[model samples]
Target: MQVLTIISGVVGIATSGTEVWHGIYTLPLPVMIVALLWTGARTREFFAER
Candidate 1:
């Protein structure tokens, strides 16, 4: 899960330039958003376990 977030974040940053300059959205953006949400939910569950 951690690895997924790291990879997605990298992808997000890479594609962000195109998104900003061209004012267009791409596939990676949605992937990144899903990865981020998944990571957040996982973290929340981990803390809740305690």
Candidate 2:
């Protein structure tokens, strides 16, 4: 799911052409990147908790 989100976000940004820098397409990339980092940080704890 996380990988899919990143892939789709990149695709969306890439396909945006001139609008690639627009907020709608650009905002999620940073958010998702942060999410990926957060997930990596928590992975061990998350599985341990599960």
Candidate 3:
């Protein structure tokens, strides 16, 4: 959970770059969305260990 936040922060910072891909500071919303989707709310507690 914490790691996901950190990853998002990093991506947000990178997305705020003025010269990102030679484009004016663009928010990496697409990447952020992807990150959020990939790491959902599922956790160890949600699974039953056999």
Candidate 4:
């Protein structure tokens, strides 16, 4: 899910340090940012309704 992307991104960066390079570690950031932006408003509305 999107939440996992965010968590994994944070963990990957924190644990990997400067070894990311042009690899999987670099992937999570764009994916996480896009996912959050794509779903943010809807998620907020859903929670606000509750």
Candidate 5:
């Protein structure tokens, strides 16, 4: 959930650069990738905890 939120936020900022600095484009892709992997890790951990 957090990962999706972050991705959406980054995408929003990237698409609408007026909100965040235009230079933010350099970071979102990497951050989004890590967020995706983190989400997967947390999801697996959740299942493992059960």
Candidate 6:
């Protein structure tokens, strides 16, 4: 789950950045936001387990 979240976040950021570079910036924003939130939650959980 943790690894998946991290990968998802990375992919989301990359996709968003690519889209923005092409001057298309509306669609990927929500995806990037969700990915960031998910990654943060997962990372927090992971650290709390240690």
Best of the candidates, TM-score: 4
1-50: candidate 2 lDDT, tens digit per residue: 65566566677677867665563555676777767777874676777755
Number of the candidate with higher TM-score, 2 or 3: 2
Q: TM-score of the candidate numbered 4? A: 0.39
Native-referenced Cα lDDT, model 1: 0.60
lDDT of 4 by residue, 6-28 (tens): 56766776687675453465666
lDDT of each: 0.60, 0.66, 0.54, 0.66, 0.66, 0.58
* Highest-lDDT candidate: 4
TM-score to native of every candidate shown: 0.33, 0.37, 0.32, 0.39, 0.35, 0.33
- Could you tell me the lDDT of residue 48 within candidate 1? 88
The sequence of per-residue lDDT tens digits that candidate 1 reaches over residues 1-50 is 54565465566667777545332234456567666776886768977855
lDDT of 2 at 48: 79
Displacement of residue 38 (Cα, Å) in model 4 is: 8.7
Clashes of each: 0, 0, 0, 0, 0, 0
The alpha-carbon deviation from the true structure for residue 46 of candidate 5, after best TM-score superposition, in angstroms, is 9.2
Model 2 ranges off by over 4 Å: 18-50
* lDDT for residue 22 in candidate 2, whole number 0-100: 62
Please, what are the lDDT tens digits per residue for candidate 6 over residues 1-50? 54555455566667776544333333356557666876876778977855
On the 0 to 100 scale, the lDDT of residue 9 in model 2 is 63
| Distance from true location, Cα of 38 in model 5, Å | 0.8
| List of clashing residue pairs for candidate 4 | none
At residue 38, give the lDDT of candidate 5: 62
